[model samples]
Target: MNDKKITKESLVQMPHEDLAALVFNLSTIIQTQNEEIANLKELYKLRTAERYSSSSEQVGYLFQELEILDAVLAGQPEVEETIEVAAHSRKKRKRANACTAPADTPVCDVFHTEGAEDTMTGKDGIVYKRVEDKTINKMAVIPRKMVVECHHYAQYKALDVEAGKDNKKINLPAKTDALGASPSLVASVVVSKFDDHLPLYRQTEIFRREGFFLSRQKLASWVITYYEEL
Candidate 1:
């Protein structure tokens, strides 16, 4: 098998234990390989960004460590949860300041199986709950809603039309007008991209290829705000 390269299709036919062991070993090798690639990529970025720092090496080391762990748990027939490597999880899309119900407002309580920390910490100290209300994340639209009077038919009809909610979202690599929009909001948008697996640097070039001049700094600022808001 040393002379033959493995493909994903072949891996599936192997026994569970064999597959798990092979996957673990392959992931470890990949992690080591990626460390060099990451270092090279970061070096070029630091040189271009002019924000050279000693932490680049540290970041590469951290990635290496992560790769090792990820490799060890790469494949298991009965794996409980899918492991993902990200700066933050995208599911944290709720607002902490949501108007939650009063503490003594409910009566029915249900106990469920325990899981990850994020799922529970958001509501109570439980992963899955019997609650209905969850926080919503919405883009800020200017010019709040207003009532429109419709002078039609026998009965008077009054419609409440929301105005600001129709505001267009500016994607990264897309210029955000220098309107005095909340800086924190901008940052939040940026952070959400990474949390959601949206790599903005690559997005920048892609946008530029399509005639947009988005700066990396602008994207970075948005990411900063996103995490701060969280």
Candidate 2:
């Protein structure tokens, strides 16, 4: 039956099974539309709250909303029982000794100690050296300029004792200019782009700031080349 013609008169004239089917279909459509509206409203509210509310307030609002949804789904209206939570205090962490360095990673230790001028006069009128406060801070150094290492192998040419012809010049040690970048450099760039969510254009800008003109296309090719190699 045409939707425009679905009046009470037409519905009443329909057979019992047809009327029931029509009613069921209309109910399902209404239910689906209601659910869609509810979802859209919820999304809008969440977006508004996230944009305008404080972080803590946003978290509380979302949590409370979730609790209400859970209660509604479970068909339970019981007031949630209040439980007194023990106050939580973060424990002070003990200082760790020097950390073991990882593979392919460089680590530096910076030591801070009291200077010779740091001294004290004891009650006995005797001057004594003050106990020194020493701390070893470990840090990874980010290079301001890209580190480009050139390995120069001394090329030794041996002449045949009598009838020398030059042996094909020893192929320089493994190709360093293969990708125009070191394996580590390529790997770092790839990880920074994919794992760290940095874009190639952003990386190119960063490189430019460091006095290098790396193009986005070049960086993209580096990623593609490494992927193909792998």
Candidate 3:
């Protein structure tokens, strides 16, 4: 393989000895560049403090430093990475190539489980019921209800209390469903502000610019949580 050609394919083709030599050369160049940086820093400090007697001396010193700097930098080798150009362009997905899911796919279902809902949580957390059939409503315009059957002797006492049925007799538990805004919306708002480097106040201003109202305090907290989660 050529010294410069280190793409995945070329790397595979390189002889072991040549690859080892390339690695050593790259490491040596990195060290040389680091040393050159230190030397330049020292030179900068020394020249800035001195009051030169003549413009010619100053120019002379500058030329000498330049020569030294060039020589040091020239001694350092350039570091190049092997790029797999052929593989890269193919892997990237374009919007035009996106696939859509089937429109008629079934999503919602109702199943009766021999388990008590009190096992999860309640207004007062407890479970005690022989059997309870409950319908959990879905969050949509056309909501689907999932029916779950409770097991014998429910896990907690509150299950019986919430179901509004005797522990002995089995009955369905009714729960009121009130749709609230999804937390995903808040998460999305935070993602835009933090990851995109838009300050909360600036984002709030942009919302104002677009004739949308968003509170600054809420934006600030969302951005904070967004970064913390990341």
Candidate 4:
């Protein structure tokens, strides 16, 4: 038998007799391996079935023994059993009061007076004086509002023509590097994106709904510029 591996190229180069012998030997080896694999699979199935059958028989025997024990106990007289437990008391839980808004938070007062009058007058013609006012604090949210701020710089000319001085103008207010975006607006964008987990695209849509057209690219630019400045 040839000990060398028989590839397509080798087979083509080999003589007919050697090739025929190699083919026969390979087929015999494959048949024997397949038979061994089939035998192993059958043996595994037999062992599994035997294990399952023994476990089921043991369980059935246990159940039969329990039934016999139950019948024997039924023939005996019944006896009542009592258990003593110690008395115990549980402490009542105290409820916490609702927390009020922070003192620093801005408050908007809405007064509801009697009879549409600021002061209450009695049935008698006597006048009433204000003593104290009842106030209720509630947290409120104001929706985002977009407004345009126009800056007008006044130019002043020198009254004396002899004075060689340039015209004076008022200083402009401080603003962010991002075009058309204020410091507060940029801060809000940064908080909304990082803290509130809102995406730039969603913020753009929200701004659009609020009648302000802000592109996602523009918002991203503003956020990046603000972060870089910080």
Which candidate number maximizes lDDT? Answer: 4
lDDT of 1 by residue, 83-129 (tens): 46576434323333345565665445333434524334444554553
Best model number under TM-score: 2
What tens digits encode model 4's per-residue C-alpha lDDT throughout 113-137? Answer: 6555556678997777776777877
Flag the better candidate by lDDT, 3 or 4. Answer: 4
Q: Which stretches of candidate 4 lie over 4 Å from their true place?
A: 1-97, 114-135, 151-178
Separately for all candidates shown, the number of backbone clashes (residues 3 or more apart, or on different chains) is 8, 0, 6, 0
**Candidates sorted by lDDT, descending order?**
4, 2, 3, 1
Which whole-number lDDT from 0 to 100 does residue 178 have in model 3?
Answer: 14
- Model 2 error, position 133 (Å): 5.6
Q: In candidate 3, which residue pairs clash?
A: 126-156, 126-158, 127-156, 127-157, 128-156, 129-154
Tens digit of per-residue lDDT, candidate 2, span 89-182: 4444433332666585865665544254667787899997766566654656687567877755556565655536764355454443456667
Task: Kindly state the number of residue pairs that clash in model 3.
Answer: 6
lDDT (Cα, 0-100) at 43 in candidate 1: 87
> How do the predictions measure up, each by TM-score?
0.20, 0.41, 0.21, 0.39
Candidate rank order under TM-score = 2, 4, 3, 1
Q: Which regions of candidate 3 are displaced past 4 Å? A: 1-181, 221-230
lDDT by residue (177-208, candidate 3, tens digit) is: 11121245456566776688666778678767
In model 2, the runs with Cα more than 4 Å from the true position are 1-40, 43-115, 121-128, 131-133, 136-145, 149-179
